[model samples]
Target chain A: MSESNTPRLPLLRFVYDGLRQMVRGRVVYWSWIGLLLAGILVGGWAYIQQLQHGLVVTNLTNQVSWGFYIANFTFLVGVAAAAVMIAIPAYIFHRQDIKNIVLMGDTMAIAAVTMAILFVVADLGRPDRIWHMIPYIGNFNFPASLLAWDVVVLNGYLLLNLGISFYIIGCHYRGCEPKLKLYFPFVVLAIFWAIGIHTVTAFLFSANVGRGFWHHAILAPRFIASAFCSGPALMILGLQIIRRVSNYPIHQSVIDHLAIIMTVALQITLFFVVAELFTEFYNETEAVMSAHYLFVGLNGHDQLVPWIWTGLGMLAIATFIGTVHPLRRNLLLLNVAAVLTVIGVWIEKGMGFIIPGFVPTPIGEIYEYMPNLNEVLISLGIWSIGLLLFTLMAKAAIPIECGALRAPGIPAGKLICRPEQQAPEYRKEPVNGESES
Target chain B: MTRYAMVIDTRLCIGCGDCVVACKNENRVPAGLNRDWVVERTSGAWPRLETEFRSERCNHCDHATCVQACPTGASHHWGDTNVVLVNPDQCTGCKACIAACPYDARYITPEGYIDKCTFCHHRVEQGLDPACVATCPTRCMHFGRLDDPRSRVAQLLRERNGETLKPETGNLPNVYYLK
Candidate 1:
């Protein structure tokens, strides 16, 4: 096979091989893929119903215009931002174990951002008219609109990750060392951009002087802290799955690093929650209407009471597990913590944050909302699409990173010019890697 | 300089809801939807009930949050009329305007564009009062240029202790309620 160190990668061949690699897995992979497709099909049907009937098919009323889809969009943005957890340690801190799997983080970000955008599309009353906000093509209200700013930052972050993933994997496929000079500047921009994406999302809510619940300063920092925990928690579970199913080497040190970051992030997030709660409750002013509704009840409407408590309970338990050194080190316990963090953040940061702001709405009307069947099905469908994208991406990438897939002439398990014995991840992989087999 | 404003004398309003009905007819607001509504707020204990019936609609604020929050320039000030409007052709129905309005003033119509009280800008172009103002049974509603101190709305605000809903929001609402 002809593997070349020439700077220009063979784009067509790389794509062809990547496509071929995705379909090479056994029954479990096929089953997983089949299940995702099934979800998409049902979701697509539900989406059609939503389109024909307009948004009325969903439980979303004018009072609660944004619900399930926006909530998922919010959660996914946090997941996408969490890629920084891996990138910072990999590139900036120069940890070889983290560096080995950092591309996986990029993969995660791409899938997540893609899903976030899709969720936004799903939420739109007239999604087809989205081009109206397109910067050059439409009358995009640039600096004035926080939603406009979100459109810019989110699309920018997605492009940044796409470029980073392409360049990193292309270098590996071409059997050459990824020169820091070529990739480092973009890597640095990406880290800040990751933080920016989540920050902008938080600001989108906080800048709304109309919604007393979301109009606070702490929401932005709180979004970041919560994002760190949820993002890494997702990565930990995904990495373990990748290690089990493929030849992708996921080291204990990598898991430990992420768990440690998540633990610290969890604590910081909890502190922010406490700080915000104190501000809302200290004097019990008219402004506490939404928070009061969320925590206790407002005029006999206590629907959201169960949800917020469950989220906090999970977050608290996860934090406790992560704090104790022995428990954090235990893989089973760590996975449990990760699961708890994901569900907790989904509830806490998703509906717990968005819905309450609109609950005891600005005019002091009490309108409660629950996602209907169409909304739930559509959400499940989009999530499946995201997981499907992530699966295929990881499938194609794991082999190249492990030196199992390269330019046609390069032998399996041989990296021609990468740095020598970089770490355990760079150790000689078995010939005719199962992924290549 | 033609800053259109509404002055509702709540002291005279009898909560008949004729203003709300007139807006629905004028705007062709979707079924079971409203551009304006009567809010009957009762304060104090049962022994002493103090009630005020205020007809609420879009403020079309001088500092309109909907215009600022709209990613597309669909929500805009209508020329020299100083009235706010949503251009359906430009609206993507992102609903940022809904969340940005403290009055809960905007809603998405079945056509999938945001619909709200436009101050009957269409009728206003003919130099006529908004449907709600003209149709009020109690003659409690007045509409005119806030910039013109001689206008009825401006005169009423100058004479009465008028209050705007959620003035604390800094929205600079053009709608004032005279208690």
Candidate 2:
């Protein structure tokens, strides 16, 4: 605490402003939050049932051990990784339009990474023993285990995004530009760290040599490609919603940039899918038995066949829309593409990818897995929690970035609250006026 | 120095299912779940059909993928014997070991830890055969140290040239099946 002429405890004041910003929102805001809270309540109760009954409550079995919880975890990791698409352009290429909303990308990453960690925890049979995965405290198998590597990278990426977002937003709140020397190096590392998080997550599935479906070398590339696809697709939809609801100015250029990234990523992702299909169906050996179950059917079972095709159909339609400049430029078509890709990737990467590997067990026995109500409710709970977290972060971040809130002592701009911040004390403070005594 | 292995003689064995029942009684495995199972595999054309009932359990591989996949070192190789075992106290029940097992040999216990065949190390320590082996109706199942050349398992491996399942996986399993 340097001795200064300014008012006492600027950090406390910053926190106070941020808290006050969160509490003050319109009916729609409260309704959105209320809906998420209801989901959390139901989800929390479902998770309790799981705790009391063990994993037996879910449809997971010896044959198909990892189910819906793991599938969602896999897909969400990509969403967390997608924040880098906005980051590279905004921070590196210096697009002012993107730079305006880059804070949103980082905030979304924080929410996503937090959700990814929680999903993994929810998947664990004994969530209490999670400390056993810690390096020094418990016996964490490093180097040898890909899962150990994933745990390290996911947490590292989370902290990296947290640090970068906090520094930049804090600078905004204080009415100053964040020093490049202090935060630029971290921003650069976070760009690479994002890719690492998705790749390591892919490796977690691919390292299982016994599960031939996920054992392919192409899985990592596919993960990155679809990450670009679904990650940006989600960003597109989220940005539009933010634009419609708030005073925050999300430029049309940001949406255009994200749509382009998603288009190229979808083309590459489809190519990779073709390559996988060729590799599986070409030579046609025992190794590709899972693909048989996935694509067409093995024996009489074809449960996943319809799902895989539907997902691909959606991706193809989205890609077609994105390829046409007029269709993509139109907000309606672009949003439609975004929605399709988001759901498409969820179906493709989520249950569609995770389940098939376990279906036709190693020695060639088909035991299908269907997630019960407990898993669905618990998963919905986790998603609601992530959305709520993102909302809180975005709510605070938008006001701070818009200069509605700031450290009281910063001499520069007027502390003009947005239309929504109508609190008695938070009435816009004059830039020329003397500091509060 | 003692590498324990199981050698099942397919020629002498009937599909009696005594081993499965004995394993259940010995280990008290959960009612719906099993530590070992009997798989009936029939191959070749209809007239030339070849049917074999295999009593399958953990392979206890030298290159144990489960041990490698386990993040907490909970699914680990037991000292000296090198039999893969789960340390329930340290297990997070992540199920990575279950995914890594080429033979689908592991299962999550009702209590939450991954459970699998231990090759009856506890009974073997007392100089007795595993309950399944002792109770085999056809005297087809054999468990002994392969490191000792004089042991029946080692001798059977020499004379019969028994094969392990999914040898292409390069897991190098200790369990052998004699045709």
Model 2 segments more than 4 A misplaced: A1-7, A412-437, B46-48
Q: Residue by residue across A1-437, what tens digits does model 1's lDDT show?
A: 23354324568789989999888877878999999999999999999998898898999889988898899999999999987556886766677778878899999999999999999889888888999889999999999999999999999999999998889888888777788898889988989899899999999999888898999888889999999999999999998777666646666677878999999999999999999899889988888999988999889999889999999999999999999987987779999999999999999999888898898878878899989988999999999999999999888887788787887765565642221122344223332232211
lDDT of 2 by residue, B47-152 (tens): 9998898899999998999999999999888887768888889888889898989899998988988889988878988999988899999999999999999999
lDDT of 1 by residue, B1-179 (tens): 57899999999999999998899898888898999999999999989989999999999899998999999999999986558899999988789999999899899999888989999988888989999999998899999998988888888888888899888888888999998
Give the Å shift of residue B69 in candidate 2: 1.0
Worst 10 residues of 2 chain B by lDDT: B75-84
**Residue-level lDDT for A257 in candidate 1:** 82
lDDT of each: 0.88, 0.86
State the weakest 10-residue window (summed lDDT) of model 1 chain B.
B75-84
Model 1 TM-score on chain A:
0.93
DockQ of each model vs. true complex: 0.85, 0.81
- By lDDT, the best candidate is 1
